[model samples]
Target: MKKHFLPLILSFLLFACGNPKETNNEKLTIVTTTSMIADVAKNIGKDSVSVTALMGPGVDPHLYKATQGDLSRLQGADIILYNGLHLEGKMGEVFEKLARIKTVVPVSKGVDPTFLLSDPVFTGSIDPHIWFDVSIWSATIKEVLAIMIETDPDNEAFYEKNAIAYAQELTDLHEWVTNEIASIPYNQRILITAHDAFSYFGRAYGIEVRGLQGISTLSEFGLKDRVDLVNFIVEKQIKAVFVETSVSEKNIKAIIEGCQQKGHNVVIGGRLYSDAMGAEGTAEGTYIGMVKANVNIIVNALK
Candidate 1:
């Protein structure tokens, strides 16, 4: 028990080392760990909540560490939201500290265990990339909506109204993705990427997915893993393998080179939004836009 709780102990010790910041009382300040979570919070909260994402576009949450500045922001926020299932592995201790004093919540808390994917490499942890499956992700909105209402009961009706609209958007996006991915030839539906971040996506869209690495970017890939994936691609004659915005491209590049060595020309389909979304002002920044962008790239290259 002591060994298991060590990270939380370290986090508490480090909290006193960071400088404090002034708290804003104008609106509900929600600090999220990833761009997708921030986008969802923004959609549900609308202009009533101010959100800050600790991890930016193309940032990998699995390897991200909390800086003193990040600590300050988390400490100052009225509500903290993160996609829990060990996605923010390094920052788990920090969140444990905040949970004691603030309204710290995991967006995945609302998802059913039956719908979650278990990590094959890890003993008990589940996959954290719920945003890929719009249907599973829609369940998270209820968690966010409930928090928003509880924190500010005066605007309960307003928050409820926005939650309904956001839920509908997710439903429509799920339908769009299902229909769009169906156009790909049954055999050509294999999706290869740097890591196993798209299992939910594959399950939802009926695509056969493979990754060189494990579910989390923290898991490293070996030569045997690379060679096996390359062999699979050569055997299957897969046209394109995708690069994730949040994961390193070196491994994917190596896979491409390996395929070339085997006399198979596998091109990079396109960059997919995996762990993180696109820039704030862009279409891909939003959850719906991110899914559509990935589907467009996958279908165009594979078809």
Candidate 2:
């Protein structure tokens, strides 16, 4: 009995000592609601934290239903970040609950209220998809920096430095988008897509945007939408319409066909990464790359 007890005590001591240094080095575990927010967090957090995106490429945040794994990640996170304003639809409740337990931040909260879009569908509520405009996103990034600093005050200097660098990049990107979009003729710069996800983009770049559906993917396109867009395309003599990566192109295809039936020649501008970034490892996979790819596609197609 004494020999057996001695072995048990030694085993307990080994277990207590095992990997103590490795456990202490574990980085802050951060969970984000969407890939876009996850991308921005990574840029600012750099190597200071471990970030995970609940949604992947082409996943629609509006219709996303959180899985058990997502809840577990959120529950374990040191900080949870999401684009608020009901972008996650029903899943926003989950984040609300998590906020009670941990540091949950709506990165878009700091965006100027005036810059937000108000639509009848939402009873004049602001649009949740504010990341489409780089300038607006710059404000969101600041909110993110504040959350990061709050979570790890010891790393305040690092987060501040990274946020400044990232903000500069965003400023450059905004200027580049403005210059590139300016190259397109105003009359020829109409942006038609499967949905009205680009309202902020159009507003920012001075382009007219029409959509087959409303802001939310849950909404369906009606005959009125089709007729109005077809007429607009014919009236404007627009050359092409765009489809989104996450949304079905069926509606846009119908629009293209309707325009052709009316003898109005139009083609698909190319697929735009609206709700998601490009496939991993591609140039358009990152947030900055995604915005640049979109600008390049729009400028090339419209110009």
Candidate 3:
């Protein structure tokens, strides 16, 4: 079916399933585009909301296309939250269609423009990976809180309390990441990865970052880009290049081999959670835990 038919199909499904508002006897249902957003919503909404993430562990949101099941979940939800800033690049049309009938909010909307990073390759576009910086991600928590409170006014106090507690944890996480990344020798504080997902992390933690691909993993790097990156790695004697959990390891592997060809041996550093988090029930599963995991990996490899 044509992509524009999503809303029409969703409408038919909703009609067949009965009105969600009149049914849905459980807590408020929230459907988020990424696991990171789901984690934040769950923390803020707590027991007051039932949350589900369309993308799972190691799923790249940039190229993700919503399946028919996802449409149903989204259509049935009381709130639909996404990273926005074109993070869910392929699902924009679906979101636009759903917005007409229900509450579909971009959690990034509340973030100050001054705090956003520009996409170098795409002029007039902002990088969508704001969650890499714990401080910036904390802003999204407030956005989720505001929407939840607005949608369920009776639980305003409850949502506010949860947001306050989550905010403090994020504050502590930001400090911890800063100190840990600082431990890496200043010159050795470079993070090379498959794609440019960690620019916010590097900015927040004082590390220099390079990626083979552009901000989006879907953006390809040509032979010249690879050669240049290899030359830089060899010249700087960079210890390692990391792979992303969500992106292919092929690009990083190519970088490592290119360095070796020039007699500069570089190993694959531990994989980092870029666009996605770890599986559910794991330490890296939650937003804070994922940040800590990445910090520990970078510090251990680069320090």
Candidate 4:
């Protein structure tokens, strides 16, 4: 048992090393856990700061374990940002250690609890995937703005301007999502994915969401869970079920097979960016782009 926990313990111990190495450059060295946060930093910081994401596209934050290289990047980072509420469960120790000496922050820190969805499996833990709902993500933008300005006070004016512009973009995105969802016929608005990451998305958009596993992918999917989900999807005659970019498609395949066993046909709607975003350089790689792509896929499949 000790051997099994040794890796995470070793990683956390690395934070006790001296202060993060100075880049000796003008840019504010920012390291983020997810691509969404990295994109926001880039958008707000622009050319003023250098932003890096430890988990790239198709990477699931729930199960992400730090490598030696990742620990090096975190230690050398001037500022580190992550989604709180234990989203990065494996890195909790390291984040706590870094908080003692560095300005490590969680993007969800500024979000109002009234707007947050509590994780059913984890007591007192809120779902950290706020980017799905553009309205909720605006709160995260504010958090990013505050930190960026705090880290680089000299460029306060520029950061504020960029932040305001980005806020408006989120407003537009929120409206766009609402409009897109409204266009889909009433009962067909259900969003079924491999995991329960989209509860926030469903709550914000007024769609019903269900998943085989719990909110976190770390939870197991059993034979009973499979049968129940198949029954739900079949009972609703849900036209399509979706898979996630970060999670394995095996659960989805099993669900389809179960449905087939009962003689109901279900096709995979399309892959949605859940825990992670699309590959960088593509439209879905960016936060806004990821949301739009997901909405398009959902609407196309069920409509």
Tens-digit lDDT track of model 1 for 127-146:
88888888888777778877
Clashes of 4: 0
- What does candidate 3's lDDT look like per residue over 1-303, in tens digits? 222222332232211111123233469899999999999899977777899999999899999999999999999999999999999999999999999999999999967688799999989999999988777777787678778878886666667666767776777787788889989999999999999998888887899999999999889789999999999999999998899899988878988888999999999889999999999999999998998898888888887
Give the clash count for model 3.
0
List the candidate 2 regions with Cα displacement exceeding 4 Å.
Answer: 1-24
lDDT of 2 by residue, 1-303 (tens): 211322332232211111112335667788988888888788777887899988888888889999999888889899888888888887977877777778998888877787789864768667777888787877767778778867776666666666666776877787788889989987888898888889889888788888888888887767887999999999989998999999988888999899999999999999999988887678787889999999999989999
List pairs with backbone clashes in candidate 1. Answer: none
Task: TM-score for candidate 3, please give it.
Answer: 0.91
What's model 2's TM-score? 0.90
7: Cα error in model 3, Å: 40
Better by lDDT, candidate 4 or 3: 3
Query: Which 10 successive residues of model 4 have the least lDDT summed?
Result: 9-18
Error of 2 at 62 (Å): 1.1
lDDT of model 4 at residue 70? Answer: 92
Give the local distance difference test score of model 2. 0.81
TM-scores, all candidates, are 0.91, 0.90, 0.91, 0.90
The segments of candidate 1 whose C-alpha lies over 4 angstroms from its true place after superposition are 1-25
Which residue runs of candidate 4 sit more than 4 Å off their true CA positions? 1-25
